[model samples]
Target chain A: MARSLTKAYERVKNIDWEPSYISAADKYVEATRFYLPKKALDPFKTFIREYFLMEREKESRHYALLEAASRLQGSNPEPRWMEGMKFALSNLSAIEYSAGRQMGRMARVVAPMELRQGYMMQVLDEMRHTQLELNALRHHMRSWQDPSGYDIALKAAGNSVGAGIFRALAEDFSTCDAVETSLGLQVLIETAYSNIFFVGLSSAAAQSGDQVMASTMLTIQSDESRHMANGYATLMTLLQDDRNIPLIQEAFDKWSWRGHMGFEVGLSLFADYFVKHKTESAREMSQRWLLDDFYGGFYKKLAKYGIKEPRWLPDVIRNSEWASHTAAVYLFGAWPVFYHRYDPIDEREMEWFEKKYPGWYSHYGKFWEAYQQMTDADAGMLVTKELGGLPAFCQVCQLPWIFPRPDASTGSTIEREGRTIAFCSPACKSIFENDPNHYSGFKTFYDLYDGWDLADVIVDLGYVREDGKTLMAQPVLEPRRMWTVDDIRRCRYEVTSPLRKTAGVSAGGSPHSAVP
Target chain B: MSTEKMWIEERDIVGVKLIAGEEAEAAAAVISESYPDAVIERYPAYLSIEAPKEVVFDLRQISERLGRPYDAPTFLVIMSSYHGRINVDDDRITLSSEIVRPE
Candidate 1:
């Protein structure tokens, strides 16, 4: 009887291949084939490899939970990792909302039946990610309240140091054409930039002993790898014809820079500030994955295919040294919104900075030193005096106009219909120029605060307590808490000065390189 | 300044870290078969087996070494931390850094 059942299963394995029976060409168009003629495309003999792997993703959850349990081994949550986890959890809704909607949209417009089938799995994976992240959050929330204030945080929370990038990601999926969206969101964002989280950030999650964060990220990454491949397949299939070259190149320029905007901010802040230990600098990881591998290696391979480096490459490489440091200075002031206590850059970490990035201290250290001096004088005063005022805004990203070091950009702007629109750089201007209908006249964060004071703006954005004056500060639970002004001072003390925070485990390496 | 970069070059390399046992040996062997550059680092409890960019754990290869049937989902059980995205299916698994753009 079992043999008969196996025979029945095998009978359906051979799908109808005759072009007469609803040909893939007549009924379904290749997603990128609009740019390339059908003759230019490669024949897909079997289902794309990504489609098959996603089918297996259905079983990944069974193992993800067990793996989390194995790593936990009945210990309490590690406080620092938990803090980073909370920030990760708070930031989840933007991507979750985008992925869920985009995948469903993809099924409609995406031409090939197999490609659409793969996106169906991605839709499930994105929804699964939402649930898994919620589970991870719930596990951590058992010990403490969800510090994200995510429930109350504004829908357009791009009002601060970095959250804007997450907020902007929605449009790439929801509005862009199939080819553009796949190349941008799936290829550049999902495949390329995701390593910062899955490999680099996830490793930090593990080292900090938050198995739920680590395992959840790792499992989510399994889906990403396939979805990424699906995107890559589209690029390769389309690139087979030179007619599609310019179309793909344009996409490569725009998305690659935009993909890294929030990424530069979040990953930098996470690595430099939030981790239990400084295992790797954000700059070092960016240098490896972004420079040495992605551009130096993978993008180089594409040169033969006639694709140029992203238009923003030079500026990105220049800013790689400065992006995190630029962000860290501002983020320290915006700590409540970010949902983690800011440990003032410690002396050793500063030394780590100087060693890892030459002349980094000269470029950014004085700002840290000045902030430290201000905090030392009076922590309460530092918030009101220094961090007040609108640091300029970029028309495109809506993030603070932080670039070119030290002072904020005076900003280049175009005269438009009686008003001037300011931009952080020419690349942002060029990106804006490409689609003025969709992009231009969008309000920067500065525009949102037309008449309100900074504190009132924060209050309006739900960053205030019921009492009104108290900004809703999220506390780091251990390695010391952050309830009082003194605790804030103590957190700074832990990072810097004569008495520095010691590594709980060995500093040079982990007990097991595998686990590390 | 000695001028040697300190942070280990483990950023986007993909492989498995397994508790030392026959399973570890099986994993290491399968990895070595596919990638000549694969290396193993020994610690107190586990073996850190890795290949640059990615490591493939072909279910057929690993199962042949272990003398048992293995599913790709079982990677979660064996790996402690992997440095690249994980792609798995019935026959093969690729721990790929570049997301495997089809040639």
Candidate 2:
């Protein structure tokens, strides 16, 4: 059993599972200190509640599988195989929870109940897949090399991937449900994966299709389709919900862009690497069939729901091709360098990219043209001061870094409302616009300094009163003084703004003014 | 004398807005070859490839021709993968997703 399993087992076993799982899940709740503590606290709490529920569901399924596998008598390969499938399903549940957590952080916050219910079903389905896959992999473990190197990287990368997603989720206080519901959750995963990776691997596992590994993926996918339907129904219902229309629109504007972009890392990487190796272009196959049948058909049906096609929909569809091309090159070229610790990108890999992804090679040529000028032979590429941190706003999406740019559209740019919002590309802009409010809510550490509210400034300056009554400002904090948005900019040293300066004296003798 | 015009059952349109590249030329050729009657219109950022009949919007092939990959999330990918444009005339269909606004 994995160390994580032992840890999880310890955690879950201690919790009383009677009445409701949420009762046990409540122990995990911890407070996050924000500048405006009450403004979005309730929503954020609700958001985390849903997150914990999903986490609990994942823990429950994992232990159940371990228990079943341990009890099974070693008889036929069938029982052993079943154990592997259970393990795979358990892992997938974890993956879904991770994905959902990231999605929430993107500010496309789903209501606690809605997210809990939807994810609960998905959690069960994913568990089913985990069990099936683990069963198959168990038999092959002795023959197969221990998958630590790549597996560890995949897990680590996958975990960090959601952090950016959560930052995006933290944006919106309302309308998270819309974002979660809009995309047919299962269909979105199935169509994207099927087009990119799932179909090819499943086809290869025909003999062992029922052996656990293959069965797990297929079973999960089958369950995913149902989840997708649920997501679709929920979205449709939400859109039609007179109370939820505006919220739905807001959620769509935020989550659609972030969610669409989220598909890039896995979808593009798998499509270019795995699909191309299968002798068919992932982009071509998906565009010709899966996307049209799933993504397209689903979008078309939205007309009846009175939901306008999302602003990002057009761009997501358009740029998917480019994303695939970039995925082929980046993962193939960069994976060996960055992701995998084995084999430098040699002539063979380059040759494979050229043959399989000729377009990416030619396009990346431009990037390298500029890159070579800055990079050294020994150090490789140098990180410049200008490239230090992501700009206050997202370049493409304009919402923030919570949303990422698509694979190939990295350098793509956009402009919004006279503000030169540089997105990694145009696709992000579409997605970003889908939920500007959510993206706008992504306050940086610097926001505390810039806000006119004296209380906000004091808290931002890292000054806290022991009694929680008064905060003293520090003079040396220059880093926090830096401001964004020329209009909202304020002085760091003193309460210079006329409104606050006058209000502070009038309201009370204390230099601190109530935050507006 | 009255002339009888032929009735068209379905005039589905497949369109692509190609970002600048060598793929621009390749996309054009593919469009011309696959969709002979396609209406090709050029813009500063992208080339709009539109056809009356269905045409495959293969990003790999297009980018292969152009030399740059579509890097970010954009409507182009979804459009290429999915079919049917937003008929702005229809107000009932909500095109909004979690992160998108309706048309």
Error of 1 at B26 (Å): 3.8
Model 1 lDDT per residue over A354-401, tens place: 887787777777667665654432233343134333344566765555
Top candidate on lDDT is 1
Name the lDDT value of residue B46 in candidate 1. Answer: 48
Clash totals for all candidate models: 0, 110
Q: Which stretches in model 1 have alpha-carbon errors above 4 Å?
A: A1-80, A145-161, A336-338, A373-379, A407-411, A465-469, A474-516, B1-25, B33-36, B40-56, B65-67, B72-90, B93-103
TM-score of candidate 2 versus the correct structure, residues matched by position = 0.44
Candidate 1, residue A497: how far the Cα is off, in Å? 36
DockQ of predictions, in order shown = 0.17, 0.02
